[model samples]
Target chain A: MPHLIVEYSSNLEGFPEAHALDALNATIIASGQVQYEQDLKSRTIRTEQFVIGNDPTALRGFVHAELRLLAGRTPEVKRDLSERIAAVLRELTPHPEGMLVQLSVDIVDMDRAAYYKGTL
Target chain B: MPHLIVEYSSNLEGFPEAHALDALNATIIASGQVQYEQDLKSRTIRTEQFVIGNDPTALRGFVHAELRLLAGRTPEVKRDLSERIAAVLRELTPHPEGMLVQLSVDIVDMDRAAYYKGTL
Candidate 1:
């Protein structure tokens, strides 16, 4: 399984609102790209806001997302997940003509990183 | 400075093609967001591909990008850099309506991570 981390940055806001998060979760589950009942049952996803641009006048803000998906590393699978997540973000946040928004994905090697262990 | 890592995934290929990487680097230098002469000059950005979806019949392929930007922890800067990078990517890789591409940025805390040095 591949632990996929999707982070998005754009000059927008008002995310994780109402059923947005739920919608994302549902989409992931329905896609069957992940094991909603097992591997992805307790996965964590976070969204935050940030600013960019040289001159403050250039661009305004950006919304970022971090999604952790547990799965094996396969070129094809990674591509699919990346597209699905991007499609969802585009739908969620519509940008203006000149405005800019970006999405980045990180496929983490779970074995290399240590997961949290509950205290004894 | 913020070490910004931008990762992009999409159903596309032929990236880092010829002067593409050079163009990206030049744009970053002109942006003035990073001290290209110093703090921003020596940085790394990597791009890769991955696949997603289950049906294998529904949707396929994705191009991913990972960029490292170094700057202070500021919201505005992150947003601008994200948009600029995305704009560049969009221009570079024109995707089809159905094809999905994603970009995720990770602002790494340089102090917490160690930089490699030539040791005896």
Candidate 2:
């Protein structure tokens, strides 16, 4: 299963949550690397308070994404997926006035031997 | 670096964010499995909208914690840490009225060669 979690600043406006999920899901499906679409899970978390860099007085915005997948993909596939995700975020997230905006995507290789899955 | 991300339902009340963080950090430090305190990062994310299981008619609460660290720890250490985290969650999270509450902890081994880290 590949789980994508997006954490963004609550101050950011015009966030298209549904479109972003579809973009990510489509990217993953187009890659043809994952096992199945049913295993994909994506969601966004809006953070109310956060700090960026060393600035304490100024407000900043960020959209940081984390992708967790069962280990076995080549570096090229991971890189491509990450680039696609970053592109989606860049397209969806609007630039704030007088604020620094940063977008980052990280791919974490989940250990198959250690991961446990069960249905509730 | 070891990062701990806690995602809980926003509908849940009486959440002790600071105390929970301190408890988790202390548990990790007490285990003495990680390198140093500087390498640890912990934060909570309150999700507003979420669905659990097949029940769309009822509200449910969940506390899911994820710990990411450099690969090298034994299974015993991971299990111990997970148990400690679950204990923290169980003790801290209040059971909502007539709602199902579930707690889960997962330890993800971050691939050293694949994980990219940089200062913002």
Best candidate according to lDDT: 2
Candidate 1 structure quality by residue, lDDT tens digits, A1-120: 323333333234444443545555666666776643334432323323233433334443333333454335465655555456555655765464565444333333344255552324
Of candidate 1 chain B, the 10-residue stretch with the lowest lDDT total is B111-120
Candidate 2, residue A38: the lDDT equals 44
Model 1, docking class = incorrect
Score candidate 1 by TM-score against the native: 0.41
Per-candidate TM-scores read: 0.41, 0.58
- Model 1 chain A: weakest 10-residue lDDT segment is A41-50
Residue-wise C-alpha lDDT for candidate 2, range B51-73, written one tens digit per residue: 34323465566777889888888
Among all windows of 10 consecutive residues in model 2 chain A, the one with the lowest summed lDDT is A111-120
How many angstroms is residue B54 displaced in model 1 relative to the true structure, after the best TM-score fit? 47
- Please give, for residues B1-120, the per-residue lDDT of candidate 1 as tens digits: 222333334245444432443455556657676653222211222334444765666554443334454225477766766566666666776465675555444444331121211100
- Please provide TM-scores computed only on chain A for all of the candidate models, following their numbering: 0.61, 0.90
Best model per TM-score: 2
